[model samples]
Target: MGHMLWPFGTTWRPVRQRHRGTVDLRWLSARTWTRRWYPQGVDLGEWQGRRTLAVSWFRQKLDGTHLASRVAFVDLERSRHLDVLLAIDEDGMLQPAPIHAGGLAWFGDRLFVAATGRGIWEFDLSAIRRVRGAEARRVAGLSGRGVRASALVAVRTRVHPIDLRCSYLGRVFDADGTPLRRVLIGEYVTADSGRIAEYTIPETDEGRFEEQERFSPGLPRMQGAVRWGERHFVSQSDRMHPGALWTGRRDALERDRVPLPVGCEDLALDLDAKLLWSLGEHPWHRVVRGIPFRALGIDS
Candidate 1:
């Protein structure tokens, strides 16, 4: 087992409160104060209420095809990770397939994962029974493991093929309890003069995209995005500096930036705790950053 490191210099003390069987995470300010390690590769993360989910993928060449890949899910609250291998029907055998999930959305009892430039994979959480006391296995070889998808839908982004790079995907409900799929995508064309522009593409159904609303908060290099109430939050970073969390209104161009320990690859909001969460990648360890809502002038 790897030791948990408090990289930002603040000691983490137990809060004496636990949600279900998982312990609550603590932080001092808007920084990457706490760190933990998982044996899987995660490029993005999502948080809802008390649950935190991390997603990772593998891409390799198999046979003559370059589409051999799989998606891994890490249940941070339970300290467990599950690898769901992508497979296709070649003859009668289920051959390993490629499904590069870049974002994750957990709505109600459904889990939706979006592919890089392809489509979405919807999973029914109620259909998956927790497997205890067993180590994680690749889904391609498992017989009884419940990893079937409820549906796979294509995403018809309005951006051109040269500019259609999806950073993350999420779902939010309206005041009337109606659900909508919100996609955060953008393009970074050039290196020296390239500017990062983030936009929100809303779609109620699959295979279509609505009019995109571009964010003009002046923040560059958007790695992830999510919405809280009517506010839009994005994780930004540059080559010379670490990333930070920027909060602004959906209908305005102004924003407030909160500094973080490292550049974030993805962002999520824990509504129950009123905290903004971020995940960063390192060759040695995976880091998690937390910032309270009050830090960004938002009332909890």
Candidate 2:
């Protein structure tokens, strides 16, 4: 809603090809079962000199109850992972966060998770608590060595009173390809077109998002969206069939739709690695995979 506004123009098209070059994530067996927890959002960052992936997962049950959410931190080079439970500080007590963590974005030491219908919950990566002994067991039946993490605070709660289904922290480049600071928030819709908005990231510790542009992208069932330079990539899935990636420019109407892995949700772009990471949500077949930009016919 300022001078930094950019038009949100995009439309869906039929799938043209499939991105077959996907790098499967090596996940722990207990975390791969979707009946227990379904993976949603994904983002990659360097933590302690190691490339790591932070994936948000929500508890899955048949009775429409969301218990708590957890984030899986995977060491990319080592192919190992750790699950840390997400909690909220209620007065002085720690309670599980029960929102549908549909998307995530890692910026600096802060991790932003989308809370459906609410706003974004910000967590401090440096403040992840180590739970051991009785406290670990009491929290989530851990064997005295589990980890528990809590949100530092919730931000952007007063901005969008409607649904905020997905999020991504990416740069909006200028005409010469110079990167500019921006964060994009989007929604998922099955019946009609979905909307996406871009905001300037707050510099203060309050972490409020100043909306710059908003529009409906005409992409129904959108699970995630990310931007690189002038190009925007969106993932849309219906849970049963394989997902599709819609690639286009912010000022263009034509989009190249390509087939993605089944149950693909949120998207994260690793520019250094030239890979686009995503997560699959099906039970017994859940996966965290990185598809090459070449496979999507895009340069990193």
Candidate 3:
């Protein structure tokens, strides 16, 4: 609602055929899936093109899913859709499930999904099999595997005062060079202030999580988040002051704001490619693209 206000951020137009244009996932179809599982009044038409809801680099293809239940793989290197995977309501649940998935991250063999009202969910790569019965059409790489719950043990976030939702998940390291897992889960309290809680995920995915630290990064409607090296990248939507993507050091509290060409709903960084992918959710214009790695200064 607030993101729709005029000129949400500094309008930086993308360079034609270079950093410009969009990968319209809407063209990739998923009608059957949405018509059955998603609740009424849901728009399976398009993603509204604003936020980058789900993204992962899996098995050499850029796997992505959005609010429209459009699950497809894009070869960003070539800017083409290699496959369109169909969504399965394996559990026969997920009413109004279309827009519930907020973020996605890869955890070894499992893909973790931050389903807004459904809590966290996981899907096993090894368990993906063909849909049992679909007379309409079929896709090869698609699966009817059920989404399972994740054991985010020990991580206590209050729903009141602040609705601590799991915004995003990322991996980073600690001071001693030891690898540390981090989950960016927090809530916004007002139009100018909110809390950002970073949690340390256990070495074992099944174990409980411990609170690493909490930050009051006075940013409104904080959405997407990802971790790179010692810095944490976050997005904030402020109708009055153009939305922005911010970077803050994990060990320190100070943050530096980077105005995006578009307001990003979710963020995922590909360090190897040196590309920062963002999902822009502006009401009139929705786009997905990668910006230069140098822009964020998270050099590999």
Best by lDDT: 2
lDDT of 1 by residue, 77-158 (tens): 5434344444444454444344444555655444555555654455443343222211122223323554543321122212
* TM-scores, one per candidate: 0.56, 0.80, 0.58
Q: Evaluate model 2: give its TM-score.
A: 0.80
Error of 2 at 162 (Å): 7.8
lDDT tens digits, residue span 169-205, model 2: 3334443444456666888778546778877766667
lDDT scores of the candidates, listed in order? 0.43, 0.65, 0.42
Backbone Cα, N, C clashes tallied per candidate: 2, 2, 8
**Superposed model 2: Cα runs more than 4 Å off:** 1-20, 26-28, 133-180, 251-257
Predicted candidate 3 versus true structure: per-residue lDDT over 1-300, tens digit per residue: 112222222222222245433223322223212222221100011112322123421111133343233233333433333122323343542111233345555444344545454444454433433333331122222234333111101111211121355544444544343444566655533464556666655455455556767776666777666666667777665653445777767445344444653445556665544565665444333445555656556455
Q: Clashing residue pairs, candidate 1? A: 86-97, 243-263
Question: What's the true lDDT of residue 34 in model 1?
Answer: 21
Judge candidate 2 at residue 129 and give its lDDT: 66
Which one is best on TM-score? 2
Global lDDT of model 2: 0.65
**Which pairs of residues clash in candidate 3, taking residues 3 or more apart in a chain or in different chains?**
8-242, 49-286, 50-280, 50-281, 51-281, 52-279, 153-208, 153-209
Pick the winner on lDDT between candidates 1 and 3.
Answer: 1
